[model samples]
Target: MEADYQPVSRTDAECLWASVRERASDPHAGIFGPSSISWKVNRESALFLGAGRAALLQLAHPWVAAALDQHSNLRNDPLARFHNTFRVVFTMIFGTLEQALAASRYLYQIHTRIQGAIPETVATYPKDSRYEANEANALLWVYATLVESALVAYECVLPPLSPGEREAYYSESKTLAALFGIPSHVLPATWLNFEAYSRGTIESAGLGVNDLSREMAHRVLQSKGTWVPVPGWYRALTTAWLPERLQEEFGLAFCRRERDAAAGARLWLPRIYGRLPATVRFTGPYLEAMSRVSGRGVGALTRTSNRFWMGQPRMMFAERGLGDAVELPQPLQ
Candidate 1:
C-alpha cells in the first residue's frame, strides 16, 4: 500500500473533479466522478462523528428499530455492525466504479434476509405489519436518515458548504440510493423536499420511542459492544449534537455543564481539525482514489500522519484492506 501512495497536485485534483462533474449527467456515469460532491464532503474523518446520531435517528422509527431488535445484532458486535454500514457508505463515496457496484450488490443481498413483522404497533404500522429492508418506504426512511445525519455531522465538524454545494451533494447522494435498488421516484426530488421529509419523519408520531430504541440509543451513547474506545468528548458531543426532538424521544438530558462542554467542543474541534494537513484529514481509500484518477501516488505524509491522528492505527490500516479493488457484478438494468 505504501508503494501506491504519492502527493496529489492541485492540477490533478481539479482535473478529476471536472471529469466527474461532466459525467454526473450520465445515468450510467460510473459510481463516483471527481465532480461528485460526496467526495468533497465525505472525505473528512468528521463524518464518522455522526454515526451514533444516525443510528439513533433510524432507531426512532419503530419499524426500523424493531427490525434491528429482531434481525440485527448491533449490541452483540457493534464494531462489525458499524464496519458493515461504513464499508458500504465509504465504498460508494470513494471506491472505483467496480468496487461501488460490488459493495452495493453485497448490501442488497444482506437486506433481502432482513424482513419480518413489527413486534408491536407504532403509529400506522400495526404489530403484524410486515417490514422488509427492501420495502421502498422503509428503505427510503433509512436512506434519508443516513443522508441527513451525515450532512448534519458535516456541518458540525467541518466548514459550512454553500447552499449550491449542499444541493449538488444531495443530488449525487440519490445516485447512491439508486445503487441500493431504491427507485428514483421514491427518493425526494430536491434538497428542499428532502428537508421537508426529514422534518416530518422526526416529528411524526410514527417515530415512537420504544424499549428497543432506548436500548440501542444507550449502546451508541456509551460506545458499548464496539472495539474502538470512543473519546469522552465525542460521546458527549453525540448527545449534544442530536436534534432536540430525538433527544427528547430518547429521554437524554444534558445538564448545563454538559451543554457547555458540547458547545465549546463543537466550536473549537472543527476549527482545529480543519487546520490539519490534508494528509491527516483524509483516509486511505480517498487518497488511493485520488491516486488512481490522477496517476500519482499519495504522499508518505499520509501514512506518517495516520500514526499521529488515528485513534487506532491498526483499525485504520485494516480499513484499507476493505477498500481494495474487488470483483464487481454488472450494473442493474
Candidate 2:
C-alpha cells in the first residue's frame, strides 16, 4: 500500500454511517427518501442507458480495472456482475434503513478482502503498486462515475436538473459515498467542484486504460454468450459518450456509421421512452420503495421485476448474511 493511502477503518465507516443515519427523516425510506432528488432522478429506468458508459469510465481507472480483472468473475459471468452491482446500489438507494445499512456493511466486508498489486506500470501508478478496495481515493473515483453518469443518462430522456437541484443531488450522494467508506474531507464540496474533479481526473494520468481494462470494456459492451447481446446503437452511444482519449485507449470505434446510429438514438429514444408504463419506466426497487411508503408491501409484479434487476425476488439480506443480526461497530464520541 502507498504510505499516503488510508484504507477506510472500521471507525471511519461507523462514524459516517451514524452521521448519515441520524439525519434521515424517514428511516424506512433509507438515507434519501421519496422527496430526494436522488429518487426523482434515479428511479427512472432510463438511467440504465448510461450503464455501459459508467462501466467503461470505471474501467479507465487503472486501480479499478486491475481489481476487477484480478479478483472479479466479470469475464465469465457478465450478467452476474451487472446484477450484483445494481443489487447493492439499489439496496442503498431504495431499501429501508436496516436494509441499506446491511448492504453497506456487506460491501465494506467484501472490500476488506480485495487487495492486490497492479500487474504493470500504468501512468502514475507503478507496477506492483498496491490497491485496496477500501482505499478512499479509488472509492471516490468509482462513486463520482456513478453520480455523473446517472445525471448524464437521466438528462438524455428527461429534462435536465436545475443548478440548485444538481447541487442537492450531489449533497445527498455524499451519504451514499459514506456507505463506500469515503471520507467527506476527500470529496469535492459541491456539484461544480465534483464535475471539475471528474473532468480533471479523466484528463490526468490517474486514469490509464490498460489492456485488461480494454478487454473488460469489450466484455461489458458485447455481452458475449448472453441470449440478449447489446444493441448496436446502444453500444455506439456508450462509445460516443466516453472521453475521446478513453475511446481511443479502449479501441472503440466511433466511425460515421456509429455516429449516425448514436445520433438516431439521441433523436428517437426520448420520444419512445416517455410513453412507457410506470411499471416499465421505473425500476423495481423504486416501485418497492413506493409500495413500502403506501403500506402495500412488495407486490408480486414488483417481485418479478426485482428478479430481473437483482436476480432474486428480494434483496435477501439475511440469506446473504447482511441482516439485522450483523453488528456494526460503534461510532466514536
Candidate 3:
C-alpha cells in the first residue's frame, strides 16, 4: 500500500537473482541465514518494483501487498503457491514482469497437484530439501499462476483504480476469497477434479473425514525431500498388485498407517517407502510414470522458449551496438 517501491540496489539484486536461480539447491546450512527465501522475495521486490512503486500504487490490490510482506521461508523450502503469490505480482507492476512469468516456467515440472487443481508452486528450499515438486505441487503452481495472471490482466483492462478505495488496499477477488476460506473455489471445475481425487483417496484408503475438509482434500499437497506424500498413497494402493517383493519394498501398510495416524509422515517414511527400488530415486515414483505415460502427468520441460528471442522484442528492446539484443533469461529460473 505504500509508494516506497524501488529496484533493489545492484548488489542486492544480483544476490537475490542468484538465490532465486538456486532455489532448489539452496542449503539449510543456516549460512544462507534464516530468512533466505524472504530475502530473495524482498530483493526481487526491489528489483521489479524499482522506480515503479509509486506509479504502480494504483495497481496493487491488498493480497498482492500481503504476499510481498509475508514471504518468510528458506530459499529451498517448498511453500504453497497461494502463500507466496505477491512477489510475482509486484514484479510485474514494476515492468519487470519477466521474473514472475519465468518463475512459472521454472515450475513446469510440477504440472499437477491436488489432482491438477491446488499447486504448491512457490516452493522455497530448506523446508523442501527433502521434497520434490510432485503432482499436487505442479497443479498448485499452474492454478495459482493462472488466477494471479488473470486477476492482474483484469486490472489492466479496467479503468485504472484509485487509492483510498477499499478494494485498492485489499484484494476483493482471489486472495480475499482464499482468506475467507470461501475463495479457492472461484476456480473452474478443474478444482472439482482435485476434490474427486482427494475423496477417492480417502474412501479407497478407508478414510472417513468429509471430502471437503482441508485435511483430506489438500493433504497430497505435502512432501518429504523429493517425494510427493499424496502419490505415495497411490503407489501404496497399487503396490498390492505389484510383485510381493515390490509390495514389501513399497510397504503399503506403513504408508496407509502413517497418513491415517495424522503424522507428518515424512518422519515415518521409512515405514512408508524406504524399501522401494533405488531406480525411483532419480526418477520419481512409479505412479508419476503412469501419469506420464497415461497422459495425465505433468508435461516435459522444453527448450523451445529460447526460440522466442528471435521474435520482435529483440528489435523493440534492442540497442545497435549490442548487436541483436532480444533476450529471454534462462528457463531454470
Clash totals, every prediction:
7, 0, 31
Once fitted onto the true fold, the runs of candidate 1 whose alpha carbons sit more than 4 angstroms away are 1-30, 296-333
lDDT of 2 by residue, 1-333 (tens): 333587899899999889878878888778898999999998999888988898889888888888888778777777777778888888889988877887888788888888899899987889998888888888888888888999999999988999999999999999999887889999999999999999998898788888888988998899973555899999999988898999899999999999999999998999999999988899898998999888987788888887777767775452335432322221100
The TM-score, computed over Cα atoms with residue i paired to residue i, of candidate 3 is 0.19
lDDT of 2 at 143: 86
lDDT tens readout by residue for model 3, 1-333 = 112222222343334334443433322221122233222222111111111211112111221212222322212222222223332322211111133234333223221110111122221211111222222222233333333333232232233334333232223222222211222333333434433533332233211122122221122223322232435433332233222432332223435553454333223443434354433221221222223235463223111211211112211111224433334321111
> lDDT scores for all predictions?
0.66, 0.83, 0.26
lDDT of 1 by residue, 1-333 (tens): 011122223343334344444444432224666677887777777777788877887788776787787776676756556655665666566666645555565566666677678777666667787766655566677788778777878888776788898899898887777656566666788999999988876776767777768888888777788666877667678888677877877888778877877788888888788787777677655665676677775566544433332322211211234642233221111
> Candidates 2 and 3: which is better by lDDT?
2
Best by lDDT: 2
> Judged by TM-score, which candidate is best?
2
Residue 112, candidate 2: alpha-carbon lDDT:
84
Better of 1 and 2 by TM-score: 2
Q: lDDT (0-100) at residue 59 of candidate 3?
A: 12
Off by over 4 Å in 2: 1-4, 317-333
